[model samples]
Target chain A: MSSIVSRNLKIYFRDKSAVFFSLLGILITVGLYFLFLGDTYTDGLADFNHPEIFMAGWIMSGLLSITSVTTTMGAFGTMVQDKEKKIYKDFYCSPIKRSVLTMGYIISSAVVGLIMTAVVLVITVVYLAANEAIVISAMLVVKMILLSALTSLSNTAMALFIVSLINSEKAFSAISGVMSALIGFLTGIYIPVGNLDEGVQMVVKCFPTSHSAVLFRQILMENSLNEGVKSYPAAAQAEALAEVKDVLGVVFKFGETECSAEMSLLILVGALVVFSSLSIFTLNRKKTA
Target chain B: MNKIVQVTSLKKSYKDVHAVKGLDFYVEEGKLFAFLGPNGAGKSTTIDMICTYLRPDSGKILLDGSEVGKNDDEIRRKIGIVFQDSVLDPILTVRENVTIRGSMYGLHGKELKEAVENACEVVGMTDFMKRPYGKLSGGQRRRVDIARALVNTPKILFLDEPTTGLDPQTRVNVWNTISDLQKQNNMTIFLTTHYMEEASDADYVVVIDDGKIAAKGTPAQLKEKYAGNYLYIVPKNKDSLLNTLKKNKITYKQNIDTISIPIVHTVDSLEILDKVRENIDSFEVIKGTMDDAFIGITGKEIRR
Candidate 1:
């Protein structure tokens, strides 16, 4: 099984074009933030203290969420390519069980997701530090690393279930293209969930990736949000943070109740379990021609 | 001889099409066995069932003594297959592909390294082991595929249309390697091919048509049963030869100046030669070929 996983990793990283395309979603988000969205958010919140740092936190959180989805999808493309080329037939002829091969694909994709997300996190942190936007904390750094790992695992399962249904490279490419185009909206990066229609907001909130984006926002934007609200009275500061969290999608609400960070974590875990089971069932019954 | 594989009344169907109908055959250990059929004649279906890639709808497939699906992992460990298409990773080097396949069978470290090198050597691909699989020519890629299959040191090796797309010379080279693997390693070889000449070299051949076994025997037995040698005579005087044949009531087919007589045995040709010597200018005896036997048993219609 490890052999299969290592083999997948070698082939995936060896293709330079695949690696670049996987990171393309994150690059696009960064470019859009710098060119347009960054100024728009800062100007709108000019009265708030340190609006630039707070908005940077928001965009970087979205970047982290999108990284897990895109890199893992790219990693699972290796399995789809193997099926297209009928290379999976060769593996099935060996002594390894079908379940083992399935796990190999999932684990390799998870590893890729983790690696790419971590790289994005490091780069984001460095850019903020170089600009002297916010003071860095060791605990925050540790929390971000843990959050990246969790998001990768959750998204790996989702990617596996999606990839299991695809049998050809052409179909896989089409799906990947669609995912790359819509992931920003799904994660509330292109249009914040709070700013969209009530119906559209519910759809975004229901998506597990949206919950991941919220969790990342809660952790990454905590310090910046506190600093931005310092000008208000002590009694109003607490209410002001709540208002800002609602406005920026740092937390989601079903109707009247706000979704706690704990609830969002539960959603991520639930997604991991449900999608992993479905993927396993689908792959075991996979029939190759 | 010990039997390595046995299939009894094995059947498989795809929806309304019966791909394999009550097929029964056994392969002896350490011998070359060939399965021959036209396109869509169920040769691949049968091979797939035997290789445990597909399940038979009915009947039993036993490898060594264990039934299929019951002990498939054990059976898989003892057999290796080189599919009709090259299944190795194109981006990976030949050595990497072989090593990964070997590791799947539980070999690791020094053992895996040795196995990869030895398998490459067996197919004369040692020098090209470091090259990417896609970079190799057709014949070289084929040899590397064979080497990958060999890495596990399986007791039986299955090759499905192994030389279907190679040049004639390359086909011969691949055949030579397959022959050496069987001879030197005492491994049972089960293969399917469209080329009758390649099947002719097998110890046993089975021909199937429309999901049923049409013929199964040794090459010599099939030749004798379905194909007969012919005596072709180019007579100096066609009129005289025709009169003599008419008077003697001899069975012959006339094509212009030449007469073809089916020879049941060598002595029949000698007797005909002596009788027709007076009118004949030249005569030749053409031995029956596997190509003739195949066409004679399977008929001439094209299958979709």
Candidate 2:
């Protein structure tokens, strides 16, 4: 399994195109936020003096959350090619067990996710600092880094489970096509959950990935959110803050019940465990092919 | 039987199609064994079971005295396989490919380097170890695959039509490499090939048709049973040869130029050769080949 893991890592890094293409979704999301929809989203939130920073945190957090997923999906691109070319048959007929091959793919993809997400985090931090938007707190940086690792694991597992169901490059290419185009919107980066209909809002809230968006918004926009509200009188600012939190999924709601940031983190972790178990179980049965 | 591999009552089927039907065969240690059959003869399916890649429906397979499917790792460590298809990562260099495979068997550092060198030496692949796999010719890539399999010094080597797609010259190179490996290491070689001439290199041969073993024997033994030896004589004078044939009571078929006699053994052919010696202008003895034996038993050629 270690050999398989090392080989996958080497293969992924050697293919320059794979590395660049894996981050394409994140790049597209950034492009859309700045050039395509920035003014529209910022113009509506005229109440906040620096709404751009808040939205940047939202988009960057969403990108970090989904990076592990799309990059891992790129990592599994190697496996899909191996299957298509029947190179996997050699490994199958070798002494190595099939479970090893499955595990190797999952672990290496997680590693790929971690590396890509870290690079993106560095870029996000620099961008936030240049704009004088981030709180620049030690605790906030530490929290963001820890959350990046957790989301990387969750996204890798989720990506692997989906990869297990597919056998062809053509099918996976179609999926990646859809993901690059729609993943940002799905994660609430393009359209905030509050602005969408109740049904669409529920999807963004219940979706395991959107949890990362909420956690990020709380940390990255903490200073700006507070400063933006301080200009107004205390009572009106308090009501408005409460309203935005509910609308933007900063605090999740189910009927009268409210979920804290900790609850959302638990959900992401739960998704990681479930998707990983399902991927390993299903792959072990069919990996010999 | 000093067997390296043994299978009894083995059966495998996919849905309604019975791929292998209660097959039985054993490969002796330190000898090349050929599994011969036409296309769809279940040759690969049988290899798959013996290699423990597929589970048999009802049967037993033992490799080097250990049960195959039950102790898969044991069976795996004792054997190395160069598959019929290309299995190398095209983008990686040959050394990288070999090193990764060696790691799987838990060899590293000095041991890995020596094993890699030895394997490449055996297949004459050391010169091209640094080249990208995809850049090499088909024959060179095959040799690299052979090196990968040999790096572990497996006790048994399985070659599933290793030379199927090579040109005539490269095919001979591959066969020579295989023969040299057997001579140096005494490894048991289990091979499947459509080239009937290659079977003559095997110490034993088994013919399968429709998932059943049709015949099994030493190459010489199969020739004796199915493909008869013959003597052909072209006499300068037909009258003299005819008189000798009549007196000897030889059952012979005479074409315009040659008289052919089906003989069972060398002694029989030599006796007839003595009688026709004075009258014959040119005489030749014909020994049966594996191709003849194959056609005699299965009534079809070994190609699709």
Candidate 3:
């Protein structure tokens, strides 16, 4: 595992264009956020108005979605390139377990996503600090990183699945673009779920991206556990949301909540396992085909 | 000698096209076996199956007596493959690529380092160890690829058109490296090449045409079997010589260039030699080559 990780890190660091594009993505997200909402903050933490919250949520959600799409694109694109060059054949023929290949790519892509997410976090924190809206906490930083990594894994898995079904880069690109757009729009990245009809909001909630956006927004907005819980009507909805918030808050240093962080951690970890298994199954199909 | 690899009735199809049609062959241990075939004759398909990259549609493969399908991981551990296409990671340095491949075989730390160094040395790539693989010349990259495969010290190595696009000089260099590795390690090698010269160096050669075995034997044996001894030629302009041979009732096959007679004894009779010299503008005898044998057996020239 360490060998695979080290090798992936080496490949990731070697490509200057990949690094530049990733940084550019983070910069654009941050720059857009500040351009729209930087001047809105007033006096301390009380300045959390609807538009300020909306912009903050938008920046977080948009950045996360872009990071997810870009990381998936880069990871699967590299895989396709490797396939074309027959590099995957060399690696596949080696004694390394297929699980190692899957994990190595996922972990490397997650790292990139984490890095991009960090850039956004730093930019947002700095802007917020400059505006004197709120003080940035180390706990929030940790939550953002963990959530970003999870989202990256999910995205990478989806990309791997897409790559398995097609053999051409043009087709992969077209599909990836369409899928990313749909995922982004459906997850309420461009338009807030609050602005959309309840039916549309219900449709959005069916996707993992919608859940990820909500989770990310909660983490970035510094929303309290009680405040988050009260927004849910049903007991189960409140319980699930409270549980997730507790896990996010505990990992990052947010206020205490009614649920254990272990449960939320399990959910994220479970999602990783499920998605990774799906990716591996897809990889097997490709190899056997 | 023990059979190192056995493939029985292997079949692979890509949709409607049958790539390999019920192919069967076995390679003995420590022998350099050459699979000679034209393009799309299932050479790569066979190699891919043996390396466990492509699963066969039917039949079975046994490597060193263990079923390949049942134990793909073990099979993979014992075999090293150099693909027809370049497989080197362009983003990695030469040394890094070797080390990573070695590590996959459970080598690491000093062992991995030493293996990488030795493989580089063997391929004459020591000087370019630090160079990124993408930056190297094509020949250099191929050498690195060879080193990467060798780093694991596999029991069997598969070379799929190893010198397909290389220049003459680089091809020779690559062959030399492979030869040295074979001699020093006593590794069983399965090589697929279109080049007759490459096939000539192998201990055994299997000529495949249209996904079936055209012939299989050592170079000398194949030449002897398909190419008859002593091709006698009568020049076109030597009408008297041809008439003399005809009057003598000498049996021969006539083509545009000359009339050929397959004979057991040498053309050393003075009377026959003098008649030929007196009437013929020119005449010559030449031994046949493997290329001729391939043409004789397959009834078609091996296309480039």
Q: What lDDT tens digits, residue by residue, belong to model 3 across residues A129-245?
A: 564434567877677667777766665665556666667667766765566446545765554554456676557545544556666655555453333344455666555553443
In model 1, how large is the Cα lDDT of residue B40? 87
CA displacement after TM-score superposition, residue B208 of candidate 1 (Å): 1.7
lDDT of 3 by residue, B148-213 (tens): 888887889899999988999999988988887888888899999988888889999998888788
Rank by DockQ (best first)? 1, 3, 2
Better of 2 and 3 by DockQ: 3
Name the fnat for model 1: 0.88
| lDDT digits (tens) for residues A1-289 of candidate 2 | 7778888988888888877787788888778778978888778777876777776766776777778778888998888888888777667667776677777888899999999999989988888777777857798789989999998898888888888888899998888777767777777777777788878877777888888878877777776677666656877998877777676656767766887889989999999999989987878777554
Q: Model 1: what is its DockQ? A: 0.84
Looking at model 1, the pairs that clash are none
In model 3, what lDDT does residue B1 have? 89
> Which candidate number has the best DockQ?
1
**Docking level of model 2:** medium
* TM-score to true structure, per model: 0.95, 0.89, 0.80
lDDT of 1 by residue, B1-304 (tens): 9989999999999999999999999999999999989988999989888888888899999998878979998988888898999899889999899999999999999999999999999999999878999899999999998998889888999999999899999999999999988898889999998888788999899998888899999999898878888999999998888788888888889987789988787568888777778888998888888877887898854231
Candidate 2 off by > 4 Å: A81-89, A92-97, A229-235, A242-258, A284-289, B228-285
How many times do residue backbones clash in model 2? 0
Best of the two (1, 2) by TM-score: 1
Score each candidate by Cα lDDT: 0.87, 0.84, 0.70
